[model samples]
Target: MQATRTDQPSASPVAPPPPLSLQTRMVLLSYFAYFFYYFCRKHLGVATPAMVNSGISDTTIGWVQTAYGVCYAIGQFLSGALGDRLGPRIALTTGMILSGIASLAFGLFPIVGVLVIALSLNGLFQSTGWSNSCKVVAEWVNPVNRGKVMGFWTTCYIFGSIAANVVAGTILARYGWHHVFLFTGITVAVVGVIQGIFLINRPADRGYAIELEERSSPATDNTRSGFMLMIRQPAVLLLGLAYTGLKYVRYTVFSWSPYYLVSSIGLAEESAAYASNGLEIGGILGLLLGGWVGDRFFPGNRVRLALFALIGMIGAILLYRVTSGTGGLWGNLIGLGAIGLFLYIADAIVSGIAAQDIGGAENTASAAGIINGIGSTAQLFSGIVPIWLKQRWGWDAVFISFIVIAFFSCLAILPVARKGKLTKA
Candidate 1:
């Protein structure tokens, strides 16, 4: 009773949030950051026909792409671990600036060896954007709305690829491949500066509580140990495994679709780039629809929705292969778009949403790194496999191989769906 007496501390009023406008700004910056990353990366694919025409061999191209893929995959592990330590803001800004420099250097030289070094470096820098963006999204968004939010955000890459094709197509039509690299590289660097100026690393930095309800967990640990801990979890490992196949197929599409259209389907080089937008358009639709389905129909169980999309992807890829030749231009567009839709829906759900749910706030970057890094390792094969299959068995076998992968990828996630709890890492 000695201190219980008269004077009670006055209750202070909690300040109100600055409005959704701030959140919108963060999301927009992140979207553009990723958009530019893809723009810098994918325009090279659009430029490949010209590069090949410039006396670069298909075998050389495969080697160059493999170099990039290897560096990109390895960079994912290193940057993801460092991102957790240094924060997304610094990591993203640094990556964007360096990637742009690398792309610019790639355009300045036409020699195969030099081009390989520059593009490989570009891949190394570009790898930082994925895990850092995942970390940023997880910190700002509540878990309850992560599916829908991430779905909308995932469109950046889809449309980025579309935009890259369109812009790179126009550039190649008018100026040539070098200008395409020069222009896109410069744009990415400028955007990186803007991101450094405006992007917030986390909601808590602005004195706001994260909107998601916290799950029970122990105290936070250091980045290295935490990363190792998260990677060991069964959910993370399975998700990563499924992602490997998904990325293998998707990267094949992104890297080779334009070339296929030009070489096999008989479209002009420029026209192939434009037509390739069908894949991205399909991706955009799939991501939005899939996100809504996950949130509205299966909020507590996303793995089921992912499985459905995977099954649909197998059907879609087969349909695309069947109709690509006989379906006319519009049929090809529609079929390619359908393939994009199915493949990306599964990608968005498994990589983005699952990582957020399973890894929680503390491990989002680590999980993203593990899943995306492992998946990206498949890119090494994206070039190698296509080259081997096309060289030995032809494109028909390549498509059939992808179909087989889709079936197996679906099987990888079956246990996750059965558990019905993507959050249980």
Candidate 2:
């Protein structure tokens, strides 16, 4: 008696497993979506000086920057809820479209209030990028390949930031701020349509079982009374609070790097922009190392990977300080670029890789969203940090603050490290 299809052994060669090629498309689409999201998210920082000359007061402009963060926080809460239920594919695509519109509106009319609305709208949509990507990665890949795949996916932010900084700086200088917004808006729209058509929500949706069958459908049911259950979760709370300090460093570097160079280091506007791109390049390399280290040696140990990131971050900070203080333009370039690469790698591992480890597929988005939201909220200090430090003492205070925060971020993970949990068993 031959075994039927239903009775075929899990190891049966004839039964044929699903191709992971769809998973490959999912990764590419998901990553490119994030790449575009960051492009939209980051262009404003580059355009700040331009906005200032357009009759907006520096103080008022700072508040405008804050608007992006305010919206980002709201996006964190909403995107996760949507991804957990509606599925990542829809959530991510819709977000790209919404952000595309807001980006255009912001470019067309540059009013602070209107731009705030647009940023909020953009934030709302942009929130889904990470969450949806997490869902795609979680559903299709398993423990063994997750580190490398996710690590590769993690490079997109640096790549996105590098492209935005280089392109936005040159373009804004040549074509003005409006053109930057218009170009990014169109780019994001194109990415959105392409990803939506090509990406599937889950492996099952593409007629495939999970790579390792990570979990069952009913078991993935994480629906609960909104934030109530979420807050109660230890892992969730830790994810948010720990990352808040980390965000301060991340946003401060991004939002203020240009200003730091121009105001403190005495570099020209475009030069500062160029220096900042160095950070993104370092980020790309760091992420590559992060993934390899995480999967190869540590295996399922997320905290260990995070700890390794903590060490890299310290080196990154030293470079940031030395480079920013130096008079040579080349020095600034090397230092700032190092900062961008290492710091970004640290974050990529934390949210993109670690969060998925803790939450699994069903709740991957929710986990990432909360962590990202908490970090973005640290931008509450983005404007004030520079102003406060400048007024109270000096520019050195800002760098010192980042150094302290970097250590604190590492120390904050004591709890996470103590409990060595794995997604599998």
Candidate 3:
């Protein structure tokens, strides 16, 4: 025999991963990024009443809200593209910077024209939020464990809202609303800087494996296609339609619940503020359930979970109208909380898991952004819907309009249900 076998090739030892893997760091950083994003974003919502007291008309206020919605819609689509092509870290950090600037601008200029312009800027920039979060979560978390991890991560929305309320309430009570903007802007900016330093785009970017074990599927990563590729998917289109209809109720609640309580239901300002927590609390619960149902009950049937969630949301809206004015302050608070809880089930499934199921990973952000952006376009109509009803009818008229819109939202999901079926795990 030849002497070739005398020397054996040596194998390199594998390096051990750090105490916190890249995925762990990325998850933590992503939560921070989104937490601050919500803080800056929700400030506008809490301050709307104060804005009204500053001389803005309800219609004008609605218009200002519309400006944010319009820009946010655009941002959603564009940021999805950016997230797919450039990576979520860059897209998200850029959005944070933009939102922070918008916050500063909102505080600096209290004029209607200026406020509208600034809010539009904020909305457009922050459009990056949802797409970026989707990309980040998809990157760091595995499919199997994603349900629970996402539950923890998505809780940022509620915590962010709570932060805004606590900070806004105290500051607005003492220093006034402008300070709320100032504090929000400053704090969010600081968090943004930290995110820029820490958040990595994917496990591969830093040499690690994702945490969850997903069902068998090809990878969903890359920047391979254009906007048209995203729009062409039937799943994207159908899902978008359902979501668009659904948001009429969702955005309405976000934008106007406080005003609705204070003006129509006759609750004290502080009481309305506390009651507002109901929405966030309910949302937290709903999202948790949605994730569980998607994993266990719906399992392979992610879309079915979405349909059920949407159904629950419709029921919640009906409950909202029925219970809103029935008992008094306590009743309104409890009713609003229930709405928050039930409505968020759809929110978690449709926007979170369903987006991934239909769109796949490579174009996930883009596809999801387009769908959610289009669906969220209903925010514009919802913005004006209440005003029209109130101008013509009264608070009662507006509440009736709420009922009608909720009913229409229920109808929108029928086609979606027809198209997609859930597969059990």
Best by TM-score: 1
| lDDT measured at residue 125 in model 1 versus the true structure, 0 to 100 | 91
User: How high is each candidate's TM-score?
Assistant: 0.94, 0.89, 0.88
Candidate 3: misplaced stretches above 4 Å? 1-21, 211-222, 408-411, 415-425
The lDDT of model 1 is 0.83
lDDT digits (tens) for residues 1-425 of candidate 3: 77666566689655434335666777778877877787677676677777788887778878877877888887888888888788887887778877888888778876666777887778887788887788787766666676677767777776777677767767777788788888888787777777777787876665555443343344533375635676876666766777775577767666777777788778765566666777777788877776776678666556666566656655666666767776577787677677777666766666666665555555568777887788778777767677777778876665566566555655665565555453211
RMSD of each: 2.9, 4.0, 4.1
Best by lDDT: 1
Off by over 4 Å in 2: 1-16, 213-220, 223-231
Model 2: per-residue Cα lDDT over 270-350, one tens digit each? 777777776777778878887887777777566666766666777867666765686467777677666755666567766
Cα displacement (angstroms), candidate 1, residue 353, comes to 0.7
Model 1 poorest 10 in a row by lDDT = 215-224
lDDT of each: 0.83, 0.73, 0.71
Sort all candidates by lDDT, best to worst. Answer: 1, 2, 3
Whole-model lDDT for model 2 versus the true structure?
A: 0.73
**Candidate 2 positional error at 162, Å:** 0.5
